[model samples]
Target: MDGDLRGLLPDDAQTRQEPKLMHPFKNFQLNNAIFAAIWLVFLAAVLVQVYLGAGYSARDKVWMTACVAVFSAFYFWAFGSMESHPSGWSQFSRAMLRWAVLLVIALASVPVIKTGVISYAPYLAAMLGFSVPWRKSLPIVAATGVVGTLAVWFVAPEDLGWSSLVLFATPFLLVAVGVFSQYDVSRYQLQHELDLAQQRENIATDVHDLLGHSLTVINLKSEVARRALHNNAEQAEKELKEIAELSRLALAEVRATVTQMRTPTFAGEVQGARRALETKGITAHLPERLTPAGEHETVFSWCLRELTTNVVRHSGANTCWVSVNADKLQVTDDGSGFSTDTVQNREGGLAGLRERVEAAGGRLIVRREHGLTRVLITMSGDSELMRDGAVVQEASE
Candidate 1:
């Protein structure tokens, strides 16, 4: 492939992070046996034509065979260059040069092969379609058809009818094959790109939520521990121990998040949020006991964890409320209220949470009602969002 065609193809670096199971290319190369078979079928037809053509001496046949053998070598070399490679400019240059040699062989053999050599047009046009920009290739392939059609008329007028029509149509059809191949390869490139980007985003959101929640509690405990250190040794030691424990859990959770093996549960967040709020001298209204929450437990868990962090960090009120069920999770704080626009544009945890919620096919709605900063997450019950277990049914009250 040359520079223009290489732009449409995937590079080694682009595919490195892609999942093997997801990509369509078999071993990341064109199917070698199938391409080899296609070439052999065409070569056999030409060789049969040469063997049967009148007035050709045995020595002339020998020379024609050598030309074909050499052409085959160059053709395969050009194609094999595309096989799973760290393809650089030098490799692309070599592929293009091999194509030029193939074209030269086709033209030079016209005296012996006659119009039979025009059979090379389809292969040459396909190579052009795959190796150059489509705009540059369209006219080049058209010219090959014109030349081949004329060769059919002038070089062997005895065989001009259906052969000319077939010759013209074959090249365009092969070029169409090349165009479709490019579409498939481009789709693989974009799919890899999207998967890689999502991986990065997931790592970012997990880390931000983990550290933000963990550190906020640690900060509050540190301050509490400091105030009591001189007057009350036991209380200070307890806070210090809790800080040490939080650090360990945070470290473990970070590892799991990176590995994508861990998911937060509603119960875990309830405990964590309660600790964070209480440490900040804010009363927390939280659920009792962890239950087998429905399909989107991770999303619900994340919502609770993230919303509680916002209450502790931003809200200046005394009481905070969090409630959850299958369809929705709501968190409200009677603190310094915020504008709806602020939630939309807030940096850090909430912004990351909003992204996670939307990606899960759920919505995050934030507003203020009756001096309470209210956040409502309405979950989507789509089967795809179900992470682990069956959906739980809640009885109507």
Candidate 2:
């Protein structure tokens, strides 16, 4: 059980400390599989045209038939490789290799232009649409257009003129537009993934906060109860009762925190935080309601939990106040004050809170002065601000 718990903990604290890595290929399986299948179908059609009497010479049929088989195999292999690793660059390189090979075959048609392989232009265009990324795909498509035009222009000048270039290049133009559209789709998909990741991080932090403070209070109280047990059984019994009630509240908070990210509103989170703080014997004052909390309720909830947890654990305060206004939510505590400089030197708790606060285009302020330690968190309207930057500010005087 201990081993399992340790394994479940974030890797080294350092690795978990860093930002998550993004996938290079974006949608991976869906996109790759769809494109690969399209390429395979197109190759099959090419094969039919070659062998099923599309007016090809015997040699022309053989080369086109060979190209079709090779293209299909390459599509399957590249798609599988990409599926294996969507994040790393290795699979992308493999996909590129297939594109290069197919391009070479299409370019080779120029030298053997008399072979009547020009009908397979659609297959090459399909590869462009399905395989290459926009930056590379665009240039390659243009090159293919140039080479294909030159192939027909020079190979059989009488039968195929410069005008034939446009006819041969029609498939590639269509494929180019399709590839661009897919790129837009991919961008939107990436944004959605990022939003989901942010939500997960918020949820994980909530779990950590909910359980962490409850356990700390329970431990402290249990110790107090244990010491009292030998001397005063009545006080010991009282403490144990408090522990039981606190445990139940903690369990409820855990459930609430898990569901909080999905169904966050200002009221629910504020109420949960108030209950959590009250159960821990920390006085909490919150707004009746906050206006225009927007879709950023999850972020604000996370900030509230982290600040409150810090108060219970580090601030040593008997009282805490939570205030919500136009764009800022603040937490203030009065306790045995520590040096503002000292708080900056520590990790794990306050720093993480600061990160979470600042990630949402909000700011975090930690100050110790005149027997009070205050943590003020401010969030602007933009959620993207939180995803990019999370700063650690110097504790105040």
Candidate 3:
């Protein structure tokens, strides 16, 4: 029942708090004019078919004209209100009721006038396609086609040929085409929404990883400085300076993370990782630079940042090593090695990192071997890393 009520409202009503004029017609103030023109054309067509095509008594003509007028009015009302209604049961019910009234009137009047009012089938089918679920509309449309064809066959057996078949089939064909176009539009909209959602998730994950690790380090240094202040003056001064430096770095990182447009390069990340590890009293073994022959710098930089963060936050190791090559990058820590269960339960960051790696046509692997917790990322030669690298190099040269 709730669903039915929701379906009676416009599509935008639930999403938009205030009404805004939409494209094509609303922006130009031409919607009413266009609808009026279309209705005029429809009315003219129906009058021509009734007055000229069908031979009837004056009384019957008047009745048929009244019926046509009523049918046209009902059709116009339904079409104009289509965008106001949500695409579900309420819209379908409204369309079906309109179709039912027209079908009954046309069928009943056929015996009196000796004329089958088959011309309106296309317009009725269009209404069904536009309003109802395609699956329901399709079967209904097929049934209409069969009944209309049979009616024509019985009415004039001598004229039971290709013309009758064409008349019956055209409406169904048109309805199918119209419905599929709507389906394509719906698919495009869904894809756009998914893309926007993915972008938001990526931004959130990046921000969390950036702030969480930096803040943890800053807190640890501040605590160390507090303890040293009571025992040793020189050591406390050194710790205090490091705390200030770490705070400044964190502030810069926060700014960069929020901007989202600039990504740290592999070299920059390696340097940053060394400083972070040193502050935590952990040994850092990192390469000076990584020159992989691909465009994958941003993804690699992100992976490096995430791995370094995990090492600082979770690993109790005294030493951390980062190795980068043409095809792969690995971060190893001789920390308290993590079990698969621990990683699954505690490592939400790795899941986001894994998605980023896979999107770049690379794979990320995490394992504990030889008492070392290792996070290895492998990239294919034809991956996004290479493509991005080439684009950057081209732009520079």
Candidate 4:
């Protein structure tokens, strides 16, 4: 789990101690705009109620409008603070205080003014529901409902039975909206995290494959150079120069990997596989060129690299053959063939390749027959071409 966390965080992100500054309108500009528009609509509703509702004089309407303005300001401040300072308890407490003040003012105006000014109580309940956790917000929602009911009862005790229903139902519906809104926000965040994790996995896998192959070849050449240093100066010099060239290529590959522009062609992989096989005292037979266009190139190149690596690391084979065409690639090795258990327990490199191939709308098949292990990969929607006595075993992604 700790390793997963480390992989999820970028190098710079892991090193940073302080919290990064969150831009207010970075990814959520549309959401913020919609929220602001809703607040404006609420404010307009308050003013309209103040002007049209009965039993309120000019002076009472002016005082009610003043309170509504202050309430809107406090609500905006609380909302903005929640976005900016999301972690600390101090900001949460301050926002809660602002909400409490708005509720108090709304409840206090109930006994004095017999107008729709009391409707703001439910809006405060909904805001609290949106801003805080459900456990903390539920009591506030209940209190707002009670306050609204009392205000309705005070204004017209004769109509209290039916009028009070509106007071309770309005806040209840708004609280439901707030809960669903928070749920949607949480779901979006989870999906974003999943995407980030998948991206990191791909990068880590590519870098590991790239470095592992290059370093293995480099180590082999270095050993050869050391062995020939005393007896043959020219051979040792040639090996040393190749090592330097390989190191430069490795560096370029790393840079390209970081920029997400490193695409290993099937031709390049075939050449690399041959060189790697020869270094390990294994003979490799490969085509002169295999030009698979579009997506096939990428999938086949990775399959070649993975198969070659498996041959070197897992198979005790002296001879290996690679065949590639437009739609299919087959790698065969006369190795100590894998048993059913061994294939089932395959992990790391082979497993990663299986996932890559399957995700590209293709199937990966491994077979152990006639003292040879064969790997066959074909793209989806391709015609099935039969090989002599080869039973295809498809791997799941």
Candidate 5:
């Protein structure tokens, strides 16, 4: 009666390739205009030279301005949306082409601006962070840092000549970009795995409960109809109608539960179990009143649904007993016994129930003693949870 829907759909996330995280620089990447405005300050020497006619003709300034404009626009677009771009030859080609463009601009700026290569070295290193994986980018970034540091030492800066701060900062910036980008990628992937695991667990539990109890009830009704067919035609006909209605309702429930996922109410399950047990000629001991369970209500509802289904289908009991305290639910039956094997081996819907309980920080136990079987569940060590009342035992065989 339980443990059947475990094969319906395997988690697709298990086989999925790690999703690429949003561009490592996504958070820090400013708009194109802003990025250019800030970095353009570094071009003060070139702009001053162009204004005063000190170094050369004005044409060099025109070329440098065009290059910076183009680089800033392309760099922002590429880095901000790297994650959305699909992977494969096409993506790699595009990434490489963009990196090459930036490298050309960086090199072209050197002789025109006379700041040496270190003026644009930092930008090139940032391009590497997005251009390739960290493993490849870090090594190249390290090389650029070493080269930049040496160039800064040998060539006097006609551009921003701040000295040692520039020397230490240049290399550190290169490596920092690579590390942070990789860190964002790793963090995003771990969060995705967690979401997938939680989704798989929810589907596993609901599918079993929704299908198992419904089918068991349908089977019980069929048996009732069969037994009454010859001796009581009117009763048999009523049972047939109920069987039809139940089938339709169960089908609807399966579809709805799968579509959005739902939790069944504890009150509804209690009533359902009562009707199911009555059909089996088993007397039921039920709570006289259902005071609110507040936050714990949903889990208690699922536990009752699973417990009643097992009792009606598996236990050959004359009387069914159920008790609820604040932190515990104990269902006892005068049947053969509850099988520990189902739990030990994780056999059926019972196993799904166990998972649901444990996920909510509760544990389930089943024991057999002197021809009576008892199943008890405790949550959060709070024995006062549902301790409002006791069950009113119905007289039985």
Candidate 6:
């Protein structure tokens, strides 16, 4: 029930490939832009103090304002370009350069900018907090706090007392909060991706199962209808109606499979394969009582159909036997069978089948001797076997 609810929700981010918009670069740009805009406004406030407040020397104020304006302009241009074409190294270099240049200028203007001893330290936190990783950002902010303290001790009016340490420490708290928040957001996005991938896989499996069974049924009923046409018109018409109904059901199954609401079962698959063999004039021997173990049924059932189809098309034999045990199944036929080289020429289906069976911790064997072709398939590790025996009586070759 919980898995159904999870499937109903938007898939978890960790499993799915998120579109490019959710990429880390996109998120970085947004956070960087916010921090840059805030810093720009803060610089403007500093400019106002430099010009109107009596704390700065006239010449020193002019130099500080020009330096800050240049830094602000470059900061905006760098971030804007990166937003348009985001490259990690370029963004990283630009961020580091922007913060370094701004920090240097602020350090130079400490005496002339005429704000409190710790005023510029808050801006440092805001800048690094948004752009750099927390491990790096924390140390940078901490160092800025130390510098702000020393500046207060050496440069502030000596009359101000030791209580001024509070001013230096406060901005670091804001920086710490911003860094932690960004980390949390990144983790949430990763989880969302994981959920989405699982949903897509489940949907694909459902589609394959639905289409495989329905198509086989349609093929069977249409053949029965065609064969009955020459013998009895009434029986032919009945088969045609059954075909129409089967077609409608197949369409409904296709739709449900697309939405991932339903999947094929072992019984349905065996029935479809049996019908397919009968339609093609091949005698199929399937177990009257058979049940698969858990999810292994879905994969092993597919193997049965593929193997049966190969037998009817490739082998020139009129008698076959299908035997299923608790853990394995075998198919044998009397036919003029080709060598492994000839099967290899038929597009590596045997090799692919081998891999699929091996992945499920099973084994497959194919050999021909004494005018008899035999396929011995064994599945261990708690998997129920599904097998079909078929013989081809006529062939173009």
Every model's Cα RMSD, please?
A: 21.9, 22.2, 22.0, 21.5, 23.3, 25.8
TM-score against native, each model: 0.54, 0.43, 0.49, 0.51, 0.47, 0.43
Residue range 222-340, candidate 6, lDDT tens digits = 89889889998999999889888888887887786675433334454555555555444455566542345354665566566667667767766555566665567666767566567
Q: Which TM-score value belongs to model 4?
A: 0.51
**Candidate 2, pairs of clashing residues:** 359-386, 360-386
- Model 1 lDDT tens row, 119-153: 77777776766765566667877877777777688
10 residues in a row with least lDDT, candidate 3: 24-33
Candidate 5 residue lDDT tens string, 1-397: 1224433435574334334333344323233224334554564554565556666666887877776767666666666444334343354455556667777777776766554445565666566664466666667666666665566656764433553444347635755765686676566556545644676688778878978998999899899999999999999999999989988998898787676435655555666677677656566777632444557777887898888878888888778877775677878787777568867678855799889888999988877655677778888664332321122232231
What would the per-residue lDDT of candidate 3 be over residues 1-397, giving only the tens digit for each residue?
A: 6556766778787456233323212212123223433733654665665677646567776877887777666566556545443233366676787678767766655654543466666767777876677788888888887776787777776655753654557667767776886786566556545645666688788878878987888888888888989899899899889878888887887787666645565655765686577656566767753344247777888988989988888888777877776677778887886566644654655878888888888887777755667777888643222121223323655
For 224-310, candidate 2 gives per-residue lDDT tens digits of 999999999999999999999999999998887777557555555665666566555565656653344556666776777666766
Better of 3 and 5 by TM-score: 3
TM-score of 1: 0.54
The model with the greatest lDDT is: 1
Once fitted onto the true fold, the runs of candidate 6 whose alpha carbons sit more than 4 angstroms away are 1-49, 52-57, 74-94, 108-118, 147-168, 180-184, 187-195, 215-252, 255-397
lDDT of predicted model 1:
0.70
Worst 10 residues of 2 by lDDT: 385-394
Could you tell which candidate, 2 or 4, scores higher by TM-score? 4
Candidate 3's TM-score reads 0.49
Candidate 5, clashing residue pairs? 2-349, 3-348, 3-349, 325-386, 325-387, 326-384, 326-385, 326-386, 326-387, 327-385
Candidate 5's error at 268, in angstroms?
Answer: 31
- Give the winner by lDDT: 2 or 3: 3
Error of 3 at 54 (Å): 7.3
